[model samples]
Target: MKSVQVFAPATVANVVCGYDILGFAVDAPGDEVTMRLTSTPGIRISKITGDDGRLPLDPAKNTVSASVQHYLNALGQPSLGIDIELHKKMPIGSGLGSSSASTVAGLFAINTLLDNPLTTMDLVPFAMKGEELACGHGHADNVAPALLGGFVLIRSYEPLDIIKLPFPEDMCVAIVYPEVDVPTRDARQIIRSKVQLKDAVTQWGNVAGLVSGLFMKDYALIGRSMVDVLVEPARSILIPDFYQLRELALAQGGIGFGISGSGPSVFALTKDPETAKRITNTLQQHLQKIGIRSLSFVSSVNQQGPVVIG
Candidate 1:
Protein backbone atom coordinates (compact mmCIF):
# COMPACT_ATOMS: atom_id res chain seq x y z
CA MET A 1 0.00 0.00 0.00
CA LYS A 2 1.31 3.43 -0.98
CA SER A 3 -0.87 5.25 1.54
CA VAL A 4 -3.08 4.43 4.49
CA GLN A 5 -5.41 6.39 6.76
CA VAL A 6 -6.09 5.25 10.30
CA PHE A 7 -8.23 6.36 13.25
CA ALA A 8 -7.58 5.91 16.97
CA PRO A 9 -10.24 6.58 19.57
CA ALA A 10 -9.94 8.74 22.66
CA THR A 11 -9.26 7.01 26.00
CA VAL A 12 -10.07 7.71 29.65
CA ALA A 13 -7.10 6.79 31.74
CA ASN A 14 -6.72 5.98 35.46
CA VAL A 15 -10.44 5.19 35.81
CA VAL A 16 -10.51 6.61 39.37
CA CYS A 17 -8.95 3.66 41.17
CA GLY A 18 -6.36 2.19 38.81
CA TYR A 19 -3.87 4.99 38.61
CA ASP A 20 -1.50 4.60 35.69
CA ILE A 21 -2.88 1.11 35.12
CA LEU A 22 -6.41 1.01 33.71
CA GLY A 23 -8.15 2.75 30.81
CA PHE A 24 -10.87 2.33 28.19
CA ALA A 25 -11.57 3.61 24.68
CA VAL A 26 -14.50 5.81 23.76
CA ASP A 27 -16.22 6.10 20.38
CA ALA A 28 -16.06 9.82 19.56
CA PRO A 29 -13.39 12.53 19.61
CA GLY A 30 -10.43 10.63 18.18
CA ASP A 31 -7.52 11.47 15.88
CA GLU A 32 -7.02 10.50 12.27
CA VAL A 33 -3.66 10.30 10.51
CA THR A 34 -2.97 9.72 6.84
CA MET A 35 0.46 8.41 5.92
CA ARG A 36 1.87 8.23 2.42
CA LEU A 37 5.08 6.50 1.44
CA THR A 38 7.71 8.66 -0.20
CA SER A 39 11.05 7.97 -1.88
CA THR A 40 12.79 10.93 -0.21
CA PRO A 41 14.21 8.77 2.63
CA GLY A 42 13.03 10.90 5.56
CA ILE A 43 9.89 11.64 7.57
CA ARG A 44 7.92 14.84 6.91
CA ILE A 45 4.63 16.14 8.23
CA SER A 46 2.82 17.74 5.31
CA LYS A 47 -0.26 19.01 7.15
CA ILE A 48 -1.89 19.20 10.58
CA THR A 49 -5.32 20.59 11.34
CA GLY A 50 -7.40 21.35 14.49
CA ASP A 51 -4.34 21.69 16.76
CA ASP A 52 -3.71 25.39 15.97
CA GLY A 53 -0.09 24.59 14.98
CA ARG A 54 0.76 23.94 18.61
CA LEU A 55 2.05 20.46 17.73
CA PRO A 56 5.52 20.32 16.24
CA LEU A 57 6.01 19.21 12.64
CA ASP A 58 9.49 17.85 13.20
CA PRO A 59 9.52 14.06 13.46
CA ALA A 60 11.74 14.24 16.53
CA LYS A 61 9.33 16.51 18.40
CA ASN A 62 5.84 15.57 17.21
CA THR A 63 4.17 12.61 18.92
CA VAL A 64 2.59 11.03 15.85
CA SER A 65 5.61 11.47 13.60
CA ALA A 66 7.94 10.41 16.39
CA SER A 67 5.96 7.17 16.73
CA VAL A 68 6.14 6.64 12.98
CA GLN A 69 9.90 7.14 13.07
CA HIS A 70 10.18 4.58 15.89
CA TYR A 71 8.14 2.06 13.91
CA LEU A 72 10.35 2.48 10.86
CA ASN A 73 13.47 2.04 12.99
CA ALA A 74 12.03 -1.09 14.54
CA LEU A 75 11.53 -2.51 11.04
CA GLY A 76 15.24 -1.85 10.25
CA GLN A 77 14.34 0.89 7.80
CA PRO A 78 15.23 4.11 9.52
CA SER A 79 15.67 5.91 6.22
CA LEU A 80 12.31 4.88 4.79
CA GLY A 81 10.43 8.03 3.85
CA ILE A 82 6.84 8.73 4.88
CA ASP A 83 4.62 11.81 4.76
CA ILE A 84 2.11 12.13 7.59
CA GLU A 85 -0.97 14.32 7.88
CA LEU A 86 -2.79 14.62 11.20
CA HIS A 87 -6.39 15.53 11.88
CA LYS A 88 -6.95 16.19 15.56
CA LYS A 89 -10.67 15.87 16.26
CA MET A 90 -10.25 16.14 20.02
CA PRO A 91 -9.03 18.99 22.20
CA ILE A 92 -5.37 18.88 23.14
CA GLY A 93 -4.38 18.44 26.80
CA SER A 94 -7.92 17.88 27.98
CA GLY A 95 -7.02 14.69 29.87
CA LEU A 96 -8.68 12.67 27.10
CA GLY A 97 -5.57 10.95 25.80
CA SER A 98 -5.38 13.25 22.78
CA SER A 99 -1.67 12.64 22.31
CA SER A 100 -2.09 8.88 22.61
CA ALA A 101 -4.82 8.94 19.98
CA SER A 102 -2.53 10.67 17.53
CA THR A 103 0.34 8.34 18.39
CA VAL A 104 -1.75 5.22 17.93
CA ALA A 105 -3.19 6.42 14.64
CA GLY A 106 0.21 7.06 13.13
CA LEU A 107 1.63 3.67 14.19
CA PHE A 108 -1.55 1.91 13.07
CA ALA A 109 -1.39 3.58 9.66
CA ILE A 110 2.26 2.69 9.18
CA ASN A 111 1.70 -0.90 10.31
CA THR A 112 -1.18 -1.26 7.85
CA LEU A 113 0.88 0.10 4.98
CA LEU A 114 3.57 -2.42 5.83
CA ASP A 115 0.95 -5.19 5.59
CA ASN A 116 1.15 -6.36 9.22
CA PRO A 117 4.86 -6.79 9.66
CA LEU A 118 4.33 -6.24 13.40
CA THR A 119 1.68 -7.50 15.79
CA THR A 120 -0.57 -4.99 17.55
CA MET A 121 1.25 -5.63 20.81
CA ASP A 122 4.60 -5.26 19.04
CA LEU A 123 3.70 -1.65 18.09
CA VAL A 124 3.21 -0.67 21.76
CA PRO A 125 6.80 0.28 22.53
CA PHE A 126 6.88 2.55 19.48
CA ALA A 127 3.50 4.04 20.38
CA MET A 128 4.66 4.60 23.96
CA LYS A 129 7.54 6.70 22.70
CA GLY A 130 4.96 9.33 21.93
CA GLU A 131 3.74 9.37 25.52
CA GLU A 132 7.26 9.34 26.97
CA LEU A 133 8.28 12.23 24.73
CA ALA A 134 5.16 14.18 25.66
CA CYS A 135 5.05 13.68 29.44
CA GLY A 136 8.65 12.88 30.38
CA HIS A 137 7.58 9.41 31.62
CA GLY A 138 6.12 6.39 29.88
CA HIS A 139 2.75 5.17 31.15
CA ALA A 140 0.49 2.86 29.13
CA ASP A 141 -2.92 3.46 30.75
CA ASN A 142 -3.86 5.67 27.85
CA VAL A 143 -1.74 4.13 25.12
CA ALA A 144 -2.79 0.52 25.81
CA PRO A 145 -6.51 1.16 25.50
CA ALA A 146 -6.06 3.47 22.52
CA LEU A 147 -4.14 0.74 20.73
CA LEU A 148 -5.91 -2.40 21.99
CA GLY A 149 -9.42 -1.02 22.51
CA GLY A 150 -11.90 -1.88 25.31
CA PHE A 151 -10.97 -1.69 28.99
CA VAL A 152 -7.34 -2.59 29.68
CA LEU A 153 -5.41 -3.35 32.83
CA ILE A 154 -1.67 -2.83 32.95
CA ARG A 155 -0.96 -5.80 35.19
CA SER A 156 2.77 -5.31 35.23
CA TYR A 157 4.86 -2.65 33.52
CA GLU A 158 8.25 -4.10 34.33
CA PRO A 159 7.78 -6.41 31.36
CA LEU A 160 4.91 -4.39 29.90
CA ASP A 161 2.13 -6.86 30.59
CA ILE A 162 -1.45 -5.78 29.76
CA ILE A 163 -4.82 -7.52 29.87
CA LYS A 164 -8.13 -6.52 28.30
CA LEU A 165 -11.07 -6.45 30.75
CA PRO A 166 -14.72 -7.05 30.20
CA PHE A 167 -17.12 -4.24 29.35
CA PRO A 168 -20.82 -4.91 28.94
CA GLU A 169 -22.36 -4.00 25.63
CA ASP A 170 -25.09 -1.92 27.30
CA MET A 171 -22.63 0.23 29.18
CA CYS A 172 -22.11 3.85 28.15
CA VAL A 173 -19.91 6.69 29.30
CA ALA A 174 -20.51 10.43 29.37
CA ILE A 175 -17.44 12.57 28.87
CA VAL A 176 -17.31 16.33 29.45
CA TYR A 177 -14.38 18.38 28.25
CA PRO A 178 -14.47 21.91 29.50
CA GLU A 179 -12.73 24.64 27.51
CA VAL A 180 -9.63 24.27 29.60
CA ASP A 181 -6.20 22.69 29.25
CA VAL A 182 -4.46 20.56 31.87
CA PRO A 183 -1.09 19.40 30.64
CA THR A 184 -0.25 15.92 31.89
CA ARG A 185 3.14 17.09 33.06
CA ASP A 186 1.58 19.74 35.27
CA ALA A 187 -1.03 17.35 36.58
CA ARG A 188 1.56 14.74 37.51
CA GLN A 189 3.55 17.27 39.50
CA ILE A 190 0.60 18.00 41.77
CA ILE A 191 0.19 14.39 42.87
CA ARG A 192 2.06 13.31 45.99
CA SER A 193 4.46 10.45 45.46
CA LYS A 194 3.40 8.73 48.64
CA VAL A 195 0.02 8.05 50.20
CA GLN A 196 -1.14 7.24 53.70
CA LEU A 197 -1.42 3.53 54.42
CA LYS A 198 -5.14 3.92 54.97
CA ASP A 199 -5.58 5.62 51.64
CA ALA A 200 -3.44 3.03 49.91
CA VAL A 201 -5.48 0.21 51.33
CA THR A 202 -8.69 1.89 50.23
CA GLN A 203 -7.31 2.29 46.74
CA TRP A 204 -6.27 -1.32 46.59
CA GLY A 205 -9.71 -2.54 47.64
CA ASN A 206 -11.42 -0.29 45.13
CA VAL A 207 -9.19 -1.42 42.30
CA ALA A 208 -9.84 -5.07 43.07
CA GLY A 209 -13.56 -4.43 43.39
CA LEU A 210 -13.58 -2.62 40.04
CA VAL A 211 -11.93 -5.52 38.28
CA SER A 212 -14.28 -8.00 39.89
CA GLY A 213 -17.33 -5.86 39.05
CA LEU A 214 -16.46 -5.83 35.39
CA PHE A 215 -15.95 -9.57 35.24
CA MET A 216 -19.19 -10.12 37.10
CA LYS A 217 -21.09 -7.58 35.00
CA ASP A 218 -22.30 -5.95 38.19
CA TYR A 219 -22.81 -2.29 37.28
CA ALA A 220 -23.58 -1.24 40.86
CA LEU A 221 -20.38 -2.77 42.12
CA ILE A 222 -18.49 -1.06 39.38
CA GLY A 223 -20.05 2.28 40.29
CA ARG A 224 -19.29 1.98 43.95
CA SER A 225 -15.78 0.82 43.16
CA MET A 226 -14.90 3.90 41.14
CA VAL A 227 -13.68 5.74 44.19
CA ASP A 228 -10.16 7.12 44.12
CA VAL A 229 -8.66 7.56 47.58
CA LEU A 230 -5.28 8.84 46.48
CA VAL A 231 -4.85 10.89 43.29
CA GLU A 232 -8.33 12.23 42.79
CA PRO A 233 -8.36 14.20 46.02
CA ALA A 234 -5.28 16.08 44.92
CA ARG A 235 -5.77 16.41 41.17
CA SER A 236 -9.48 17.21 41.29
CA ILE A 237 -8.93 20.54 42.98
CA LEU A 238 -7.46 21.83 39.72
CA ILE A 239 -10.75 21.33 37.93
CA PRO A 240 -13.46 23.94 38.45
CA ASP A 241 -16.52 22.73 40.32
CA PHE A 242 -15.33 19.16 40.08
CA TYR A 243 -17.17 18.06 43.20
CA GLN A 244 -20.38 19.81 42.28
CA LEU A 245 -20.26 18.29 38.81
CA ARG A 246 -19.82 14.81 40.20
CA GLU A 247 -22.65 15.25 42.61
CA LEU A 248 -24.85 16.51 39.82
CA ALA A 249 -23.98 13.57 37.60
CA LEU A 250 -24.65 11.10 40.39
CA ALA A 251 -27.94 12.80 41.11
CA GLN A 252 -28.80 12.52 37.44
CA GLY A 253 -28.48 8.72 37.60
CA GLY A 254 -24.83 8.34 36.69
CA ILE A 255 -23.32 5.32 38.39
CA GLY A 256 -19.92 6.93 38.87
CA PHE A 257 -18.14 10.15 37.94
CA GLY A 258 -14.54 11.27 38.19
CA ILE A 259 -11.73 13.05 36.43
CA SER A 260 -10.91 11.46 33.09
CA GLY A 261 -7.11 11.39 33.03
CA SER A 262 -5.84 14.19 35.23
CA GLY A 263 -8.25 17.09 35.37
CA PRO A 264 -10.43 19.49 33.33
CA SER A 265 -12.06 16.56 31.56
CA VAL A 266 -14.48 14.35 33.52
CA PHE A 267 -16.50 11.23 32.80
CA ALA A 268 -19.49 9.34 34.20
CA LEU A 269 -20.53 5.76 33.60
CA THR A 270 -24.10 4.62 33.26
CA LYS A 271 -25.76 1.32 32.52
CA ASP A 272 -27.93 2.80 29.78
CA PRO A 273 -27.62 5.38 27.05
CA GLU A 274 -30.46 7.54 28.40
CA THR A 275 -28.76 7.91 31.76
CA ALA A 276 -25.50 8.69 30.03
CA LYS A 277 -27.13 11.42 27.97
CA ARG A 278 -28.83 12.88 31.00
CA ILE A 279 -25.62 13.01 32.97
CA THR A 280 -23.76 14.63 30.07
CA ASN A 281 -26.42 17.28 29.67
CA THR A 282 -26.51 18.02 33.38
CA LEU A 283 -22.75 18.26 33.62
CA GLN A 284 -22.48 20.54 30.60
CA GLN A 285 -25.21 22.78 31.99
CA HIS A 286 -23.54 22.85 35.40
CA LEU A 287 -20.24 23.90 33.86
CA GLN A 288 -22.03 26.58 31.89
CA LYS A 289 -23.77 27.87 35.00
CA ILE A 290 -20.33 28.28 36.54
CA GLY A 291 -19.30 30.25 33.39
CA ILE A 292 -17.09 27.46 32.08
CA ARG A 293 -18.31 26.48 28.64
CA SER A 294 -17.94 22.74 28.05
CA LEU A 295 -18.30 20.08 25.40
CA SER A 296 -20.02 16.84 26.33
CA PHE A 297 -20.71 13.58 24.53
CA VAL A 298 -22.00 10.13 25.37
CA SER A 299 -20.35 7.11 23.84
CA SER A 300 -20.51 3.37 24.09
CA VAL A 301 -17.22 1.63 24.81
CA ASN A 302 -15.15 1.40 21.63
CA GLN A 303 -14.50 -2.28 20.83
CA GLN A 304 -12.11 -1.55 17.97
CA GLY A 305 -8.96 0.32 18.77
CA PRO A 306 -7.27 1.75 15.68
CA VAL A 307 -8.24 0.75 12.15
CA VAL A 308 -7.62 1.86 8.60
CA ILE A 309 -10.21 4.28 7.29
CA GLY A 310 -9.67 3.43 3.62
Candidate 2:
Protein backbone atom coordinates (compact mmCIF):
# COMPACT_ATOMS: atom_id res chain seq x y z
CA MET A 1 0.00 0.00 0.00
CA LYS A 2 1.16 3.52 -0.77
CA SER A 3 0.28 6.38 1.60
CA VAL A 4 0.90 10.06 1.07
CA GLN A 5 0.00 13.33 2.76
CA VAL A 6 -0.82 16.43 0.68
CA PHE A 7 -1.37 20.07 1.41
CA ALA A 8 -3.39 22.38 -0.86
CA PRO A 9 -3.03 26.04 -0.03
CA ALA A 10 -6.15 28.15 0.43
CA THR A 11 -6.98 30.32 -2.58
CA VAL A 12 -8.62 33.74 -2.94
CA ALA A 13 -10.99 33.66 -5.88
CA ASN A 14 -12.58 36.51 -7.80
CA VAL A 15 -10.12 38.96 -6.23
CA VAL A 16 -12.28 42.07 -6.87
CA CYS A 17 -12.12 42.45 -10.63
CA GLY A 18 -12.13 38.91 -11.96
CA TYR A 19 -15.24 36.97 -11.07
CA ASP A 20 -15.15 33.24 -11.83
CA ILE A 21 -11.99 33.94 -13.75
CA LEU A 22 -9.13 34.79 -11.37
CA GLY A 23 -7.56 33.39 -8.16
CA PHE A 24 -4.30 33.35 -6.17
CA ALA A 25 -2.94 31.23 -3.32
CA VAL A 26 -1.78 31.96 0.23
CA ASP A 27 0.63 29.81 2.24
CA ALA A 28 -0.19 30.13 5.96
CA PRO A 29 -3.92 29.37 5.74
CA GLY A 30 -4.75 26.10 3.99
CA ASP A 31 -6.15 22.56 4.36
CA GLU A 32 -4.63 19.09 4.34
CA VAL A 33 -5.88 15.66 3.26
CA THR A 34 -4.25 12.22 3.40
CA MET A 35 -4.80 9.34 1.01
CA ARG A 36 -3.62 5.77 0.67
CA LEU A 37 -4.29 3.05 -1.84
CA THR A 38 -5.72 -0.10 -0.35
CA SER A 39 -5.30 -3.74 -1.27
CA THR A 40 -8.96 -3.99 -2.22
CA PRO A 41 -10.68 -2.49 -5.24
CA GLY A 42 -13.16 0.06 -3.87
CA ILE A 43 -13.18 3.66 -2.60
CA ARG A 44 -13.97 5.16 0.81
CA ILE A 45 -13.69 8.60 2.41
CA SER A 46 -13.78 9.85 5.99
CA LYS A 47 -13.62 13.30 7.53
CA ILE A 48 -11.55 12.82 10.64
CA THR A 49 -10.67 16.32 11.79
CA GLY A 50 -11.57 20.03 11.65
CA ASP A 51 -14.98 21.52 10.64
CA ASP A 52 -16.65 20.51 13.89
CA GLY A 53 -19.71 18.67 12.42
CA ARG A 54 -20.17 20.94 9.40
CA LEU A 55 -19.16 18.79 6.41
CA PRO A 56 -20.58 15.56 5.02
CA LEU A 57 -18.30 12.51 4.85
CA ASP A 58 -20.08 10.40 2.30
CA PRO A 59 -18.21 9.76 -0.96
CA ALA A 60 -21.08 11.14 -2.98
CA LYS A 61 -20.93 14.50 -1.23
CA ASN A 62 -17.28 14.89 -0.22
CA THR A 63 -14.95 16.85 -2.52
CA VAL A 64 -11.90 14.60 -2.08
CA SER A 65 -13.79 11.41 -2.80
CA ALA A 66 -15.20 12.73 -6.05
CA SER A 67 -11.84 13.89 -7.42
CA VAL A 68 -10.14 10.58 -6.74
CA GLN A 69 -13.02 8.75 -8.35
CA HIS A 70 -12.72 10.95 -11.43
CA TYR A 71 -9.00 10.25 -11.64
CA LEU A 72 -9.56 6.53 -11.32
CA ASN A 73 -12.16 6.53 -14.04
CA ALA A 74 -9.90 8.36 -16.46
CA LEU A 75 -7.03 5.98 -15.81
CA GLY A 76 -9.22 2.90 -16.40
CA GLN A 77 -8.84 2.00 -12.73
CA PRO A 78 -12.43 2.02 -11.63
CA SER A 79 -11.85 -1.13 -9.67
CA LEU A 80 -8.86 0.37 -7.85
CA GLY A 81 -9.32 0.79 -4.13
CA ILE A 82 -8.42 3.82 -2.04
CA ASP A 83 -9.07 5.14 1.45
CA ILE A 84 -9.24 8.89 1.93
CA GLU A 85 -9.26 11.07 5.03
CA LEU A 86 -9.93 14.82 5.06
CA HIS A 87 -8.66 17.42 7.54
CA LYS A 88 -10.81 20.47 7.15
CA LYS A 89 -8.17 22.85 8.50
CA MET A 90 -9.88 25.55 6.50
CA PRO A 91 -13.48 26.32 7.40
CA ILE A 92 -16.24 25.20 5.10
CA GLY A 93 -17.70 27.86 2.79
CA SER A 94 -15.06 30.31 3.99
CA GLY A 95 -14.30 31.28 0.37
CA LEU A 96 -10.64 30.29 0.83
CA GLY A 97 -10.94 27.50 -1.68
CA SER A 98 -12.14 25.11 1.04
CA SER A 99 -13.60 22.66 -1.43
CA SER A 100 -10.88 23.24 -3.98
CA ALA A 101 -8.22 22.30 -1.44
CA SER A 102 -10.02 19.05 -0.73
CA THR A 103 -10.23 18.20 -4.40
CA VAL A 104 -6.60 19.06 -5.09
CA ALA A 105 -5.26 17.02 -2.15
CA GLY A 106 -7.31 13.98 -3.08
CA LEU A 107 -6.39 14.10 -6.76
CA PHE A 108 -2.68 14.75 -6.10
CA ALA A 109 -2.47 11.93 -3.57
CA ILE A 110 -4.01 9.42 -5.95
CA ASN A 111 -1.81 10.45 -8.86
CA THR A 112 1.35 10.07 -6.77
CA LEU A 113 0.26 6.76 -5.29
CA LEU A 114 -0.53 5.45 -8.73
CA ASP A 115 2.94 6.32 -10.01
CA ASN A 116 2.19 9.76 -11.46
CA PRO A 117 -0.37 8.75 -14.02
CA LEU A 118 -1.32 12.30 -14.99
CA THR A 119 0.25 15.74 -15.38
CA THR A 120 -0.84 18.88 -13.51
CA MET A 121 -2.16 20.37 -16.75
CA ASP A 122 -4.21 17.25 -17.44
CA LEU A 123 -5.48 17.10 -13.86
CA VAL A 124 -7.03 20.60 -13.79
CA PRO A 125 -10.33 19.57 -15.43
CA PHE A 126 -10.61 16.65 -13.06
CA ALA A 127 -10.05 18.95 -10.07
CA MET A 128 -12.80 21.21 -11.45
CA LYS A 129 -15.30 18.35 -11.16
CA GLY A 130 -15.13 18.72 -7.38
CA GLU A 131 -16.09 22.40 -7.60
CA GLU A 132 -19.04 21.55 -9.84
CA LEU A 133 -20.46 19.37 -7.09
CA ALA A 134 -20.45 22.34 -4.71
CA CYS A 135 -21.47 25.36 -6.82
CA GLY A 136 -23.10 23.71 -9.85
CA HIS A 137 -20.48 25.61 -11.85
CA GLY A 138 -16.84 24.69 -12.50
CA HIS A 139 -14.49 27.65 -12.72
CA ALA A 140 -10.84 26.58 -12.95
CA ASP A 141 -9.50 29.86 -11.61
CA ASN A 142 -9.52 28.72 -7.98
CA VAL A 143 -8.64 25.06 -8.44
CA ALA A 144 -5.77 25.83 -10.79
CA PRO A 145 -4.15 28.17 -8.29
CA ALA A 146 -4.83 25.94 -5.28
CA LEU A 147 -3.10 23.14 -7.13
CA LEU A 148 -0.49 25.14 -9.03
CA GLY A 149 -0.12 28.14 -6.68
CA GLY A 150 0.95 31.76 -7.40
CA PHE A 151 -1.39 33.95 -9.52
CA VAL A 152 -3.49 32.49 -12.34
CA LEU A 153 -5.17 34.26 -15.24
CA ILE A 154 -7.89 32.15 -16.83
CA ARG A 155 -8.52 33.32 -20.40
CA SER A 156 -11.17 30.83 -21.56
CA TYR A 157 -12.97 27.90 -19.98
CA GLU A 158 -13.82 26.00 -23.15
CA PRO A 159 -10.19 25.61 -24.18
CA LEU A 160 -8.97 25.51 -20.54
CA ASP A 161 -5.81 27.61 -20.79
CA ILE A 162 -4.25 29.84 -18.07
CA ILE A 163 -1.08 31.87 -17.74
CA LYS A 164 0.90 31.62 -14.51
CA LEU A 165 2.49 34.94 -13.66
CA PRO A 166 5.71 35.58 -11.79
CA PHE A 167 4.65 36.98 -8.42
CA PRO A 168 6.48 39.75 -6.57
CA GLU A 169 8.54 38.88 -3.49
CA ASP A 170 7.32 41.84 -1.42
CA MET A 171 3.62 41.06 -1.84
CA CYS A 172 1.43 40.28 1.14
CA VAL A 173 -2.25 39.36 1.12
CA ALA A 174 -4.51 39.69 4.14
CA ILE A 175 -7.76 37.73 3.97
CA VAL A 176 -10.69 38.62 6.21
CA TYR A 177 -13.52 36.12 6.51
CA PRO A 178 -16.48 37.59 8.31
CA GLU A 179 -18.19 34.76 10.20
CA VAL A 180 -21.03 34.92 7.71
CA ASP A 181 -22.29 32.63 5.00
CA VAL A 182 -22.79 33.71 1.40
CA PRO A 183 -23.77 30.84 -0.82
CA THR A 184 -21.74 30.73 -4.04
CA ARG A 185 -24.92 30.23 -6.00
CA ASP A 186 -26.66 33.12 -4.23
CA ALA A 187 -23.68 35.40 -4.80
CA ARG A 188 -23.63 34.54 -8.49
CA GLN A 189 -27.33 35.44 -8.77
CA ILE A 190 -26.76 38.84 -7.19
CA ILE A 191 -24.65 39.96 -10.16
CA ARG A 192 -26.47 42.02 -12.77
CA SER A 193 -28.18 40.18 -15.61
CA LYS A 194 -26.27 42.40 -18.06
CA VAL A 195 -23.56 45.04 -17.98
CA GLN A 196 -23.42 48.45 -19.69
CA LEU A 197 -21.18 48.73 -22.77
CA LYS A 198 -18.87 51.22 -21.09
CA ASP A 199 -18.52 48.95 -18.06
CA ALA A 200 -17.86 45.93 -20.25
CA VAL A 201 -15.12 47.73 -22.18
CA THR A 202 -13.54 48.98 -18.98
CA GLN A 203 -13.84 45.59 -17.34
CA TRP A 204 -11.92 43.88 -20.14
CA GLY A 205 -9.39 46.66 -20.24
CA ASN A 206 -8.77 46.30 -16.52
CA VAL A 207 -8.43 42.55 -16.93
CA ALA A 208 -5.79 43.16 -19.57
CA GLY A 209 -3.95 45.60 -17.36
CA LEU A 210 -4.14 43.31 -14.33
CA VAL A 211 -2.56 40.56 -16.37
CA SER A 212 0.20 42.87 -17.53
CA GLY A 213 0.82 44.42 -14.09
CA LEU A 214 2.07 41.15 -12.68
CA PHE A 215 4.70 40.84 -15.42
CA MET A 216 5.94 44.33 -14.70
CA LYS A 217 5.72 43.88 -10.88
CA ASP A 218 3.79 47.14 -10.60
CA TYR A 219 1.90 46.79 -7.31
CA ALA A 220 -0.03 50.02 -7.79
CA LEU A 221 -1.29 49.04 -11.21
CA ILE A 222 -2.15 45.65 -9.81
CA GLY A 223 -4.20 47.36 -7.11
CA ARG A 224 -5.76 49.79 -9.55
CA SER A 225 -6.66 46.97 -11.91
CA MET A 226 -8.43 45.26 -9.04
CA VAL A 227 -11.42 47.53 -9.69
CA ASP A 228 -14.71 45.83 -10.52
CA VAL A 229 -17.43 47.73 -12.43
CA LEU A 230 -19.78 44.87 -13.22
CA VAL A 231 -20.57 42.12 -10.72
CA GLU A 232 -19.43 43.92 -7.58
CA PRO A 233 -22.16 46.58 -7.74
CA ALA A 234 -24.93 44.00 -7.48
CA ARG A 235 -23.06 41.61 -5.17
CA SER A 236 -22.14 44.35 -2.69
CA ILE A 237 -25.76 44.38 -1.59
CA LEU A 238 -25.35 40.90 -0.19
CA ILE A 239 -22.53 41.94 2.13
CA PRO A 240 -23.43 44.34 4.91
CA ASP A 241 -21.43 47.58 4.75
CA PHE A 242 -19.38 46.06 1.94
CA TYR A 243 -18.57 49.30 0.15
CA GLN A 244 -17.91 51.30 3.30
CA LEU A 245 -15.57 48.66 4.66
CA ARG A 246 -13.71 48.29 1.34
CA GLU A 247 -13.06 52.02 1.21
CA LEU A 248 -11.74 52.05 4.77
CA ALA A 249 -9.21 49.29 4.04
CA LEU A 250 -7.94 51.09 0.95
CA ALA A 251 -7.64 54.36 2.82
CA GLN A 252 -5.60 52.78 5.63
CA GLY A 253 -2.37 52.30 3.66
CA GLY A 254 -3.52 49.08 2.03
CA ILE A 255 -2.84 48.67 -1.67
CA GLY A 256 -6.46 47.71 -2.38
CA PHE A 257 -9.44 45.99 -0.88
CA GLY A 258 -12.38 44.14 -2.43
CA ILE A 259 -14.76 41.19 -2.20
CA SER A 260 -13.12 37.83 -1.73
CA GLY A 261 -14.91 35.40 -3.97
CA SER A 262 -18.67 35.89 -4.07
CA GLY A 263 -18.36 36.96 -0.53
CA PRO A 264 -19.25 38.52 2.68
CA SER A 265 -15.49 37.97 3.09
CA VAL A 266 -13.03 40.72 2.08
CA PHE A 267 -9.26 40.93 1.44
CA ALA A 268 -6.49 43.42 0.72
CA LEU A 269 -3.04 43.37 -0.87
CA THR A 270 -0.14 45.22 0.70
CA LYS A 271 3.50 45.88 -0.09
CA ASP A 272 4.79 44.54 3.22
CA PRO A 273 3.76 42.51 6.24
CA GLU A 274 3.44 45.62 8.40
CA THR A 275 0.87 47.13 6.07
CA ALA A 276 -0.97 43.83 5.92
CA LYS A 277 -1.19 43.71 9.70
CA ARG A 278 -2.41 47.29 9.88
CA ILE A 279 -5.08 46.61 7.27
CA THR A 280 -6.30 43.52 9.07
CA ASN A 281 -6.76 45.46 12.33
CA THR A 282 -8.61 48.30 10.64
CA LEU A 283 -10.88 45.99 8.64
CA GLN A 284 -11.76 43.81 11.62
CA GLN A 285 -12.36 46.82 13.86
CA HIS A 286 -14.66 48.36 11.27
CA LEU A 287 -16.57 45.12 10.89
CA GLN A 288 -17.01 44.84 14.66
CA LYS A 289 -18.28 48.39 14.79
CA ILE A 290 -20.86 47.45 12.17
CA GLY A 291 -21.94 44.39 14.22
CA ILE A 292 -20.38 41.94 11.81
CA ARG A 293 -17.98 39.45 13.41
CA SER A 294 -14.93 38.44 11.37
CA LEU A 295 -11.66 36.46 11.45
CA SER A 296 -8.58 37.88 9.77
CA PHE A 297 -5.59 36.08 8.23
CA VAL A 298 -2.39 37.73 7.00
CA SER A 299 -0.54 35.54 4.53
CA SER A 300 2.13 36.06 1.93
CA VAL A 301 1.53 35.31 -1.74
CA ASN A 302 2.08 31.58 -2.27
CA GLN A 303 4.51 31.17 -5.13
CA GLN A 304 4.55 27.37 -5.05
CA GLY A 305 1.71 24.88 -5.38
CA PRO A 306 0.87 21.69 -3.48
CA VAL A 307 3.65 19.19 -2.83
CA VAL A 308 3.92 15.89 -0.98
CA ILE A 309 5.28 16.03 2.57
CA GLY A 310 6.85 12.63 2.70
Best by TM-score: 1
Candidate 2: RMSD to truth: 1.3
**In model 2, what lDDT does residue 204 have?**
82
Query: What TM-score does each of the candidates earn?
Result: 0.98, 0.96
RMSD of each: 0.9, 1.3
**Considering summed lDDT, which 10 consecutive residues are worst modelled in model 1?**
121-130
Off by over 4 Å in 1: none
Once model 1 is optimally superposed onto the true structure by TM-score, how far is the C-alpha of residue 12 displaced, in angstroms?
0.2
Candidate 1 residue-wise lDDT, 1-310, digit = tens: 3998899999999999999999999988799999999989989999999999899988899988888888888889999889999999998889999999999999999888888899888888888888999888788999999999999999998899989999778889999988877888999999999779998999999999999999998989999999998999889888999999999999999888999998689999998889989998888888888899898878999998998887
lDDT of each: 0.91, 0.83
Q: For residues 1-310, could you state the per-residue lDDT of candidate 2 as single tens digits? A: 7899998888888777877788999886877778888887778874458878767778878777877888888898887878888887776777788888878888888888878878876789999999999788888878999888899878789888887877678899887888888888888877777778999889888887777787889988888998999988887887778877788788877787888777777889899888888888988898899888888899998887788876
